[model samples]
Target chain A: MIRKALIPVFMLMVTFPIALLLLLSFGKSWVYPNIFPDQFTLQHWNDIYQINSELLMVTLKSIGISLGVSSVVTLLSFFSSKHISYSVYKSRWLFLAYIPYVFSPVILAATLQFYFTFVDVSGTFFGVILAQLFITYPFGVLIFSNFWNPRIKAIAELSNTLGGNSWITFYKVVLPLSKGVLLLCFFQVFLISWFEYGLTALIGVGKIKTLTLSVFQYIQEANIFLAALASCLLIIPPMILLYLNKRFIFTNQQTI
Target chain B: MTNQLLDIQNLSKAFEDEHILTQTSFFLQESKTLSILGKSGSGKTTLLKIIAGLEKQDNGTILLENNDITTLSAHKRNIVYLYQDALLFPHLNVFENIAFGLKLRKINAQEVKNRVTKMLYDLELQKHIHKMPTQLSGGQRQRVSFGRALIIQPKILLLDEPFGALDVDTRKQMQRLCKETLKQYKITTLFVTHDLKEALIMGDQIGKMQSGVLKTFKNKEEFLNDPSTGIKEEIEFWKNIHANEE
Candidate 1:
């Protein structure tokens, strides 16, 4: 009975804060130490669509970067993992693949600063994307390696003997079979790049101004309402992506 | 010699210092079933893989239709190997799985459909034609796998204990289906099994592997009389059971 009661209690625990944040975003005069706002208005929501709203610009920018990072990471990982899984060094490569995570993204970005300048992508949007790629592509590799098991190897051989060359076998056999896991990997790496701050902060030198930077800017300015609004904006895309992905994962294999 | 479809000559493979196959030689005739019996780790699977071009032998020549095909890649070898597990591609339905090879050959969509439809009925899997591999029972899945392999009309079919994973009843049913299909197609088959009875039932000629050496018998009488497989003792033991029942 207690456990059953705890379910709704836990729901309230998560939702209550989100409800408060929603109210604050629209609240005109929310005062300290008050459970409810002094006044409510729609000005902040209206501010989102103004001709030159920085928040709107930052949100669009973040979406663009997130989409790019997800595409490059998922694609590169798909091809790389296919080779790695079939390669003799399949499991052994995980040690090298995982080394990126050993350093905080900030630390890694800092160390790679000189190399970034040498390639002339330093402090640029491209530089930040590249940095995020370095840190997150390994995740795709790791996830994809698990997807490419001995059973998959057998299937690949089956396809080959059925008269498929490497290209035909990969696109027809591996790519289609792993589509669900690959889509899942896409969403996962999207969220990683979307939520990332430390790497962008260091490598981008703050010129790249992602939505996370906007939230941080509001926090520094002590505008808690706008900060909450920005945080709310940041959370919505992932929540939606996850709800759709939940249906997909349930419809497909459970291994992921 | 002229009728031989696959001739494996002086095949040798080793892992580190351990010899898995040493100077192994065998000749399989066209349209014949050759059953190989071996204990686990006796290089049965390795030999089959080598024949299918999925494994490299340290030394050997694989002659197919009198051509030295030892260096041919797996896709070009025209040999299909079925594993112990059915390994039906989970992404495809029964019909699609059956038609996978034809699609790869770029056969027209109508022909692919007609052939796959006919095969589904022939395999008695008409009801599950649209069902995913995961939705089928073990026997049904293996039948789809068998259909998938046979539809390609490979020059050689390698079975590595393909029915080993099924229950006894399913195994027996699969064995019957396998024998029937192989005979119907006249597919040159090399079936590797650890079960003596399965070998005897499926084989036109039976061979046994001990350590890394393989020996084939000319007939069932020779196989039954051979001591290496302990078949003579096994038959005597069964006879005792029948006598005790009497």
Candidate 2:
């Protein structure tokens, strides 16, 4: 009885904030000391596609950037982690992977901003993508390095002896075995690139307005309704990813 | 100029200051299994690795069926090295795991299906063909591993204490199965083990490894007579238990 009773309460606690965000996005006259909004409207939601609205473009750009960064980072780091894991100086190499995270992403981006500007990629979409890779790539390596243990190495060797060339071994054995970890790395790095503000701001130079930046823009202008809508939009992709992770990765992980 | 199917001449290896294998050489005729008996760190694994082309020898030539495979990459060597752990790919079901090598060779789909199905039946795993690696028991997994290796028709199969992780009964069963299967296939094998009984049971040609040197006995009787092989001590120890019980 207690367990059943606590379940709904827990779910409500989790969903309450989401509900409030949705309500606030639709709210027209919510003021201090008001238990409920005096009125509700769809005008704020309509602003998403209105003429001259940056919301739609910014949302699409954020999706594109996050998807690109996550895909590249996941692939590069998967291979990089395997090599580093098997290297004689494994710990030394892993320590280097951790170096980027030693400072905050913001500080790291600031330090790297000059290098980005020097390369003539500053204030560009590609620039923000490059800047996010600096952070997410190392994070990916850290996560995937743990995936390559002695057993995994032995399995790869086993594949080779079974007449599998390097490509065959990777495509047939390693990749299939690494599915769960690969999905997890992609999702985590996606989240990292999605919410990244500092590096995006520093490298983008305010010319690139991602959904995250738009949320901040609305908040700065004291437009709470629009800010709430942007926040709601920001929450959608990760929620879908979480659902995917739970549905596919974790389910497959039970067997792995 | 030699009848040996697999030949190693003056194989030597070192790791930094420590020499793992020193001037080791052996040869096995076709369809023969050479069981190498060695304790931990006896350089047995290093020897096997070099032959399988998984590791490079500091100085040696490995000839497989009269071809110098000394510089061949591991995948091209057709020498399968089986570790103690079954190490089945977790994502693949039993059939897929067994078919893995054939698939890599791009064997036709129908032929791949027939061979894997036949191999599964031979390993008595047809009923569990769809089961994932995680769903199988330890012994079942090892059988699958064996099937996976054997399906490729390897030039030589190297067993590095492949039954080390099983319980006594399973080990015996696997030993019997391995013996029967190898005989049926006439596959040359290099079986490495620390277990005395296992070494005697698994190998047609028995050798003992100590301090990076391999001493392949002329015959089983010679191996048993050698004190350094430890069979006498093992026998004496067992006889004492029987005497005490009497």
Candidate 3:
């Protein structure tokens, strides 16, 4: 009982920095001694909103890139995983899929940077998307492959016998059965794309200006306030996405 | 005969040098129930999979109505295999799950609605038509699973201990429901189980499997009244292994 009580306290303790950043985002100055900011001003937010349409464009670009990366990752994973699960050599393919995940992203990026430059595709949107897709595809494959095992195959076969074709079985039966896992995959890929800095920065070569890039630039300029605000903005979409995903997961769990 | 909807001839399967089934043969008559009874690892499921075209036989022939279906894929064979788990589509409501097969056939919306509605009503699942699979009880989920399979109206219905997960009471109820429903549709069923009582209750003819060979009986009385020492030994083997577990 005490452990349960202490959980929220622990959570708040860990989240205080983020919360403080969010709070400070609405304030003009952070020099106040009080626990809360004395003067709450939307001046920073308003300035970003009014002076820089670039910020909005960058935010949208980040979201667009994330969406593109997630969709490609999900599709690639779904097919590859489905193939792996149904194929004769499932174990071998699965082991191969695990290789990318074991390597650190830094090492991966450093190695791939040379290849991207050789292909004359380095520091472009396509290059970043491709890199992130490589990173996120394995997750999609792993999750969906696990989700696509014999149990799901049984359900699918049942559907097929009932007069469903392969496409029909996939969309109507297999996809729905693994919706939760797919959602989890989408959110995971989205988060990976959203927060991904080193790979994008390395491959993007300052050509791509995502929210993370904006935050990093502000931090480099010693503009902590702007950086905090940008970070707060960056955090909101994923937070909302995660919260929605939790609601879905919990609701499904309860139904089960 | 025209009535023999499925025929298996000397089918064999092996998994990584382990022979799961060998030289198995059977014929499933239309609208009749054939139950496969065996101890665990007796290769009952492997035989069913070979018949269903889900797993390939290293050497054998499967004929659907005298047409060799051995080379046919699972999807093309029109054989439905129900798992021990209900394996319902979690995202779809019960009605949608039941409608899954019809939709694949490109059936019209009106037809789908009418057929699914009839199934829901017939299965006494009207209240659960909108409920997700997770919202259903064990019995209810099994009924939905049955509905999903039956809705497709497959040529062959294969059950891999479909009621094994349910409580005793629910299992009994589901068994009764399954018998009643399949009888109405006149669907040919091939079910595998370790439970003698389930075999007796659900099977019109029982195929007693040892290792991979099947010794079939016309009825439960024939199986029980057999004076052959081999029959007695097989029954004892199954009883000692399966009956005591529950």
Candidate 4:
């Protein structure tokens, strides 16, 4: 049947780019009219192990920034979204959360550039993390806004009246109930921080060299091998996160 | 005054310019249930929330056991409030849901297990102990919610139309179970509902709320005799139906 025949085609289409990237990361070089590289080598992989490697440090820096941004944004957004959801002026607050998204990340970064430069956090490692939050935090708030409904509010109230302190009520009831949304929000925002380029470039002032910027720089310099390597490195964390999300959060009728 | 387990004096609440509850006051004796019957927008739920410390009153004094708990936080109030929806923790199984309050108090794990098991048996949910809340029926979920609240041995229990969403048969069954359990546990409860029969059946004392003002009756006879309670119209309607059948 057409459906059955199309399955492998669809799968190959989905996987071909990643497979090509992995293969190209080990290739020596590509020449004109060659579908594949002239030779394969692990020199680029070996380069990653060299002492004081920029690639290695940049990769770690990207992971650290994404992790930091995702965690703080997710936690802050979860609580802030709950407060906003319960507030009488809910729509007004939600409109404020939407302000950052009204512009492209680059333009938002440009507007915030003055504040960052004035505070002297621009071009610093912490600066990029803070800049990423400007985009991710509001997104996290928007994602979790739908999670806190009247029923959830009632449940929290019930927990309080059942003799649970605020901390107990959150970890015992709210966190457990919000696990799926939390994970989904964390993953999405992690990706946002991970693949972010324009905002990072503008705010980081090119001093904070993230893995995503390295990929863009390599591609611009026509360094196909290193570009593929950077792409492979970039895909690893999000793929693992996606696998974990599927295995745990979505397995047993859980929904965000 | 000493026998009065819970007392509210001059309670009032408002949202923006509209007053939801104004100058409402009542008292509940120890080990007795007070049923407040009111229609929607009658401020019955606001009164219950204020008593449970979930909402702060604009003006009031709430005395529990002659102790002024006016500004006490909700968790410290030792008051358990049940919502119309069961609102069970969906991630937890029936046993875990019942054990939630005990765990929150840092009780020993084995004792928590035993107490929750006993509560589950009492609620006739022993077979569904391992099932998640979403796997249970509405009546079963409500029973679990009750167990969760009652296992903590709260000082006062507030029910906000707890069985309002159940079917007629399930509602009757839940009412009977609730009455028996509250009696056995000697729980002083403030039960609010809109149903006339349910209000009369569930309470040792009866009150009617209208337009933010609550009037508590001394006895069933007084409540029935009062023309404002609509008891007379209810009785006449039933009597006329019976006569037509004859």
Question: Which structure among the candidates has the greatest DockQ?
Answer: 2
Q: How do the residues B41-127 of candidate 3 rate in per-residue lDDT, one tens digit apiece?
A: 989888877777767789988888889888887778788888889878776789888887777778999999999999888899999
Candidate 2 stretches with Cα past 4 Å from truth are none
CAPRI-style quality class for the chain A–B interface of candidate 2: high
lDDT string for model 4 (A1-256, tens) is 9999999999999899999999999999789999899999999999989978889999999999999999999999998998899899999999998998889999999999999999999999999999999989999999999999998888888989988888988888888788888889999999999999999999999899999999999999999999999999999998999898889778644622
Q: Could you say which candidate leads in lDDT?
A: 4
Instruction: Give the clashing pairs for model 1.
Output: none
The DockQ assigned to candidate 3 is 0.47
- Candidate 1 chain B has its poorest 10 consecutive residues by lDDT at B1-10
Ranking by lDDT: 4, 2, 1, 3
Summarize candidate 2's per-residue lDDT along B7-109 as a digit string, tens digits.
8899999999899898998899888889999999999999999998889999988988889999999999999999999999988899889989998888999
- Better by lDDT, candidate 4 or 2: 4
Residue B242 shift from truth in candidate 1, angstroms? 5.7
Q: Residues A104-165, candidate 2, lDDT per residue (tens digit)?
A: 88899889888988999999999899899988998998999899999988999999999888
If both were scored by DockQ, which would come out higher, candidate 1 or candidate 2? 2
| Deviating ranges (above 4 Å) for candidate 3 | A1-54, A85-102, A246-256, B73-76, B92-132, B151-153, B169-177, B215-230, B233-246
What's the lDDT of the predicted structure labeled candidate 1?
A: 0.89
Candidate 4 off by > 4 Å: A252-256, B244-246
Provide the TM-score for each candidate, comma-separated. Answer: 0.90, 0.95, 0.80, 0.95
